[model samples]
Target: MDQVTKIANRLADVGGVVAVCLGGSRARGTHTPDSDFDLGLYYRPPLDTSALRVLAAELTGGAVEVTEPGGWGAWVDGGGWLTVDGARIDWIYRDLDRVYRIWQQCKAGLFEVGTQAGHPLGVYSHSYAGEVAMGRILADPTNELAALQEQIQASYPQPLRDSLVAHARWEVPFTLSLARKGVTRGDAFYIAGCLFRVAGLLAHALHAQAGCWVLNEKGAVQAAGQLPTAPANFSARAHALFGALGATPDELATAINDADQLAADVLDNLSPG
Candidate 1:
């Protein structure tokens, strides 16, 4: 068996593991040669982290620490990172019950964002649903994950889309307002941070407007640029705006204005007739 298949089988055999899935770029078919593998281990409560640690050690030929549930954070939960046969692999834990609950909440147009390491914009509650929607089931003996995936794939909830778009669009101006203050104080870093947040929010709005499930902020703006509802030259304009930032107050002000204009264009495109 291939290394991935072997790994998936071993993971499935671990106690409490309900399913194994291939997520991220690989599952989305957008991966390049160097893209790492993202394997999701969906489990019930009371997972066997010790067994997972043992498997990681055996595969990597070294000690690896696997976090207990919520070790990473509330939204991220916990998992491990490993290198097998020189290929990078990420094991992400997903609680089966939580995943389903989040999906139901999203269908009702309810979700929240929570702080999580490695996610500068925070983790979206609906992302749990997005991961399942975008992931491919590699091992689901009982078809548990498969059933959820089927339901998620059947349709992108209109309420969820409307909620995401409305919330993100509303944040754009609020975030820019903060950037405006930073610009007045000539705080380049603070201004830049606000601009990045605005960009992230705009990406969210664009993706939702297009009825796309964006998993995370990584490459999200460029990805949204490809969506049918995205404003013309969206990605290029965003990149240029970032590249144009300068240290001077005048320059910072110009950048903020440009960002606001870019945001306006996006919101305009999303506007109803």
Candidate 2:
């Protein structure tokens, strides 16, 4: 860990970079051997990407796919995919300006689900609060993460919980309705997509009940499965939801009915199931 911290600190030493931190399952100590190294470099606005670009070009040996700030998406900002010493390393760019705004929004009882591509979970950006609050700090010359974590965890604000629960309550049923319609239309693909949305919303509700914050859909189920409201035999439910049976549309009608029941259960509960 010390060695990794030194590497992260060196990366933070890059011009315009304020700090570098570890993220994802590795940071949480839940990583598999195949997990990619998730590193995020936080920077203030008007950041110069030139140094980062050159470093990336050198690190990945001219196979760099770095993007400018906000090029990937608003909340995620930007970063790069690089291979160093034959290991998969994900270099993420975090705009401190945006992070601060999102953090403030969280404090002020504001949050929204990201409908942008790759975020099918519709997670609230303020959930980045988790990344900042719970994530391990690697480098903080100016103590940026310490202050950020303090502010983020200042309280387990009820409003944030209320907001997530409310969103999940509505979204789950709504998406399930779409899934039912897809079943009637014999649209297996549409039904499958809706199931993903259903699970995502259920995960949101579960997290909210536990007063937990979520950043992405990655490992959402594993995070939520331990909660009380997690469905019975969650692995089987998830497998069925994702079509482990490869159910045809006619077969999906039963799945859709089961899905509706799942949504109803989640909605009726004071806490997630």
Give TM-scores for every candidate, taking all chains together and pairing residue i with residue i: 0.95, 0.87
* Predicted structure 1: lDDT: 0.88
The deviation in Å at residue 187 for candidate 1 is 1.6
Per residue, candidate 2 scores C-alpha lDDT tens digits across 118-146 of 77665578767778876777888899877
Per-residue CA lDDT of candidate 1, range 103-157, in tens?
Answer: 9998898989899999998898888999999998888989989999999989888
User: What RMSD does model 2 have?
Assistant: 2.7
Best by TM-score: 1
> What does each candidate score in C-alpha RMSD?
1.6, 2.7
- Name the top lDDT candidate: 1
Off by over 4 Å in 2: 1-3, 57-63, 244-250, 271-273
